[model samples]
Target: MGLLDNLKARLAPAKGKVSHLAHEHGHKVTHGLDRAAKAVDEKTKGKYSDRIHTGTDKAKGAVDRLAHKDEPPAGGGDTFTPPRTPPPAS
Candidate 1:
């Protein structure tokens, strides 16, 4: 096996543990992220509020993915459909 494969093999066992921990403490993790973001925003005087919000959202998403809570529904209709917009009258 190549370097990446070997590394993945070694880390395979830890994946389950990480997922379990994330599932158990996901709310606490999210609360901590919010608290940290609020502190940073206060320190920055709201200068980077937008960027901080974005980063916080991405972090939360990562946590959800780690906890496997982002999985698609078991019903299997996972496709996305764009909303239709009506054309303006000429």
Candidate 2:
């Protein structure tokens, strides 16, 4: 087996544990993130509010993804439809 495959095999249990924990405590994790972001933003007097908001959003998204990694995609299937564009003016 390749080194990467060996590593993955070893870490599979840990990944499962993490995924379970994330799913179980995702709400608390996200709440903590929001609380911490508020404290930091308050300390910085809102100077970094925008950046802080962005970071917090990304962290929450990561947590959400981890928590839902095993779930099937919504909408029943993977069918996708592209938006139609208007015709260009002559």
Candidate 3:
């Protein structure tokens, strides 16, 4: 096997463990992130509110994505739907 493939194979179990932990502790992680962000923002006297909020949002999104990595995508299996047009008023 190639070096990269070997590395991936070795790390597969670790990745699974991480995914499981993230799924189980996702809510607590999110709550901790919120609390940390609030504390940091307060310490900085809101000078970095926008950046803090953005970072917190990205971190939460990452956690959510990781926690749901094994789940199928919403609307099911790579399906796409085009937006429907509204009917004109009579």
Q: Rank the candidates by lDDT, best first.
A: 1, 2, 3
lDDT of 3 by residue, 1-90 (tens): 999999999999898788789999999999999999999999999999999999999999888888886578776977777769876889
The alpha-carbon root-mean-square deviation between model 3 and the true structure, to one decimal in Å, is 5.5
Ten contiguous residues with the weakest lDDT in model 1 = 74-83
How many steric overlaps are in each model, in order? 0, 0, 0
Q: Give lDDT for model 2.
A: 0.91
Q: What TM-score do all the candidates reach, one by one?
A: 0.79, 0.73, 0.71
Which has the better lDDT: candidate 1, or candidate 2? 1
- lDDT of candidate 2 over 1-90, digit per residue (tens): 999999999999998788889999999999999999999999999999999999999999999888885467788566877669976889
Best by TM-score: 1
Check candidate 1 and list the clashing pairs.
none
Q: What would the TM-score be for candidate 3 when compared with the true structure?
A: 0.71
lDDT at position 62, candidate 2: 93
Stretches of model 3 off by over 4 angstroms after superposition: 1-3, 73-90
Q: Per-residue lDDT tens digits of candidate 1, residues 29-85?
A: 999999999999999999999999999999999999999998887877688767698
Computed on alpha carbons, the lDDT of every model, listed in order, comes to: 0.95, 0.91, 0.91
